[model samples]
Target chain A: MNPEMLTKWLIRWGGTAAMIAVLTAGAGDGVAQESVAVRAALVTGTLPLDDPNAAAWNNAAPAVFPMSPQVHWPERIQQVTVQDLTVRALHDGTQIAVLLEYADPTEDPDDAAAIEFMVGDKKAHFAHGQPMLLVEGGPVNIWYWKSKDNKGVDLWAKGFGTLRPHEHQDVKAKGEYANGKWRVVFSRSLATDHPDEDAQITPGQFINIAFAVWDGRKDDAGQVIEKGSQKAVSSWWYFRAEPPPDYSGYVYAGVAAVLALGFQFVLIRKLKEGQSA
Target chain B: MGRALIRPIVIMGAMYAFLKFVLPNIPGSAEIPASLIILYLLLTLSGIIIFETLSAESKDAFWGPMQRFLTGENIGGLQPLRYGILVLFPVLVGWQTYNATAPSDSPPAENRVIHPAPPGEYTGLANPVPKTPENIMQGKGFYAAFCSPCHGANFDGKGPAARGYNPPPANFADPTTIAMLQESYLFWRIKKGGVGLPIEGMPWKSAMPRWELELPDEWIWKIIMGEYDGAHQTPRTWE
Candidate 1:
């Protein structure tokens, strides 16, 4: 082969290589942004499926629901038990915080059966270990007392991010007891998953919340009678977030494209080498 | 040089063919790869130039293949240009389809309206209808305060907590579902909660309290028939 033919061949190869590099970089950038959006939606968005009220009541009621005293708890008994009811959800978009206050609904409320909203699978304190900062898409559980532990109160709740939370603000939770009845302010904002179900706690969606108290009808031992019964409360709240479009599934599609491009680049280089060989 | 190029190209091409045909490909994945698409565009333009230049040498046959330089026009078929188009079409289709459909999956909207109870013919057990409006009103009030959150106001089974429920609540208004349950079923369900029951989310795990103290036995019947299960008897803060 002459030097002239070799030179022409080398120029064509260099031009193709440069064009391939430019296309790779351009396509790679567009796809990376797309991938982030996809992952966020998959993890965070998919959880809050329906209106918290309907979703909680229709699906979660059997575990924790409200019924006339005429009906008893365990309409559908399962192996798992939910107790010590306390739940919360902060709707940042609306700037409302919601808390589910579980109490005996027998006209007279239960004073002794203090509601404990704890975190972890089994704890009696605050839900999610007294979260220092509210995690947007975190879930928390609760346990309650029915008549000084005559029977126990148990429940589970999952909190999701409806509005992007303000990480800067110190999460200030409060409790109040101004009225004749014991009214503990679980939160300041109606921001739970099922705020509507809570006659008192609104702007939140409801989950596994069991309310129990001394029925007041006691036995001869001077002790509170009956297993402090528990019931589920079905409720909902309205929450909105910025249109999911701004960020979208940019990261996810981006990653897919990136990996695809990287794979293509490597495969093509190998292919070209193999052809030349 | 011919042996060097042909040996590896023929082997790799055969492997590509085999993998493409034999593998259980992921849906939408085995298309014109991006690498192949760019290569196709380049090759097509290059082919036009290469063919035009090669054919110009044999002015009588300007449309013939470039291989005419090494093999007569009757010898080698036009294989290079043919391969380029096959690889290009799929890349275009895939990129376009992904863009068109990705945004369609949006987060669901929130619903706040309460649903009502489902009324249907009882096949199992029947409760005698209450005699007066007072009874109906009592039933309404009882359900409004208690049952409404889960069963919904209209009893169509679209309560607030409906989504997380597996085997979502039976749409009470639907005759198909209502016909399945007897008055006794509602009574039994009302009397005993369904924590561990076969009912959807009520999975034998969580059951509501026995409200025998809050309400009288008869009011249970009223709430069942009156079906104000989805109304807010008390003011909800988040409404």
Candidate 2:
């Protein structure tokens, strides 16, 4: 057997193999990549995070980072600091969420946590046991705020497994913002059959929310609204995406392409020999 | 037989690498970075390679390399650029597909356009909303009624409540020389509220009902444009 003939076989196999490999990998990823649609639009919302008595202005809340209901990846909220703080409620028809932002949470020398908010002029607090009201029925939202900060470990509220309230599951969360404040939203997602239900939502609803953040404590001097001096919630909004498809299609298509290409190559080779004869 | 098998393997590796950069950027793709592509490729490549190695081809060889491989339609004399362009085929297809499907943002929520306020001092209105001489003075009044509390009287963003706010009020008088916004810029900001600006930590309009409702459009314009302008302090005439 000639080594030169063997070398020729090797290169022929190598070149064909490379093209096959490229198509296989290319098609698989291409199919998967094509399914996705990427987007990044500037999302802005405001929430209150300051003391009631510390008065220069109490009405307006600045735009907060890590805005509401978007689940915060474990320690992702403490990335910013707040010089002054404010909190505003955002009411998406079904529920209320919060958005928080702050002074350079990245560059600060203070004792303040990454996120904080004043509920009734006192530091707002939430944990596993508390329950905060989400809406007043004044406004309607298209979708609820799921966790916006998706950590690698989990699919978070919307994409992966959700904390569905089969009976009375504890749904507790603390909203930290790029601003320096840790706000806790501890609520329980009651059962679907529960009577206290405001409204049920199909998977993909609108994401607009309008919050009515008030002192939840007492009212100041002159104000028409029910609660405290300065109170307003952030605008409403939601996010949605169609997930990627399964890979079974790739397997079948790949198998067929290879088989067909092989059969055709063989048929052509035989036909060439037959013509020569 | 051998070439066909190699095709999928190498293609898979390169494809894995390229897609790694693409996926994580898909909006909310769990901040997982691109380096993870290498990890997935390693784990997947090994498994795939193992699977293919056991199933080698069972056929005799075909024509040798010396036997000319030609285009039947036109005895093939294609240019290098042609091949180069073909090489870029996958990349171009991927990019075009992304562009078509990717979510381009909605035109920034019809920005708050500040229609020149009704003839006030700036407009020199007959009502002369406030008794101030300059719109800057009216801006002071306008801000005092609204913005100054959180932002501060001097626009130092040091209002009395300035002590504990996340993203303190923007220092309008920052001597540091920031965005040299135009005359009507402040009015647009004030009226539109902070629907999408960097006044983080404070709620939009900060309880000052969309000034569109609270102040006559004129006053909101006077307060923001007048008092916030650099003309009084920096000596540069309002361009």
- DockQ of structure 1: 0.03
Whole-model Cα lDDT per candidate? Answer: 0.38, 0.35
* Residue A277 displacement in candidate 2 (angstroms): 25
Question: Count of backbone clashes for each model?
Answer: 125, 82
Per-residue accuracy of model 2 over B1-239 as CA lDDT, tens digit each = 23645565577867775666666578877545557766777677776655545643312112221112211122255445444543454445545545555544332242332222322323222223443567666666666756665566776776654432322346767643224544444554455443323322123222222355456877765664555453244322443
After superposition, which runs of candidate 1 have C-alpha atoms over 4 Å from their true positions?
Answer: A1-259, B1-172, B182-191, B203-239
Error of 2 at B102 (Å): 5.3
**Candidate 1 lDDT over residue span A220-265, tens digit each:** 8855333333222222211222223433345455555556555655
True lDDT of residue A191, candidate 2: 18
Model 2 docking tier (incorrect/acceptable/medium/high): incorrect
Q: What ranges in model 2 sit over 4 Å off?
A: A1-138, A141-206, A209-277, B1-91, B102-142, B156-207, B210-239
Task: Measure candidate 1: CA RMSD.
Answer: 20.1
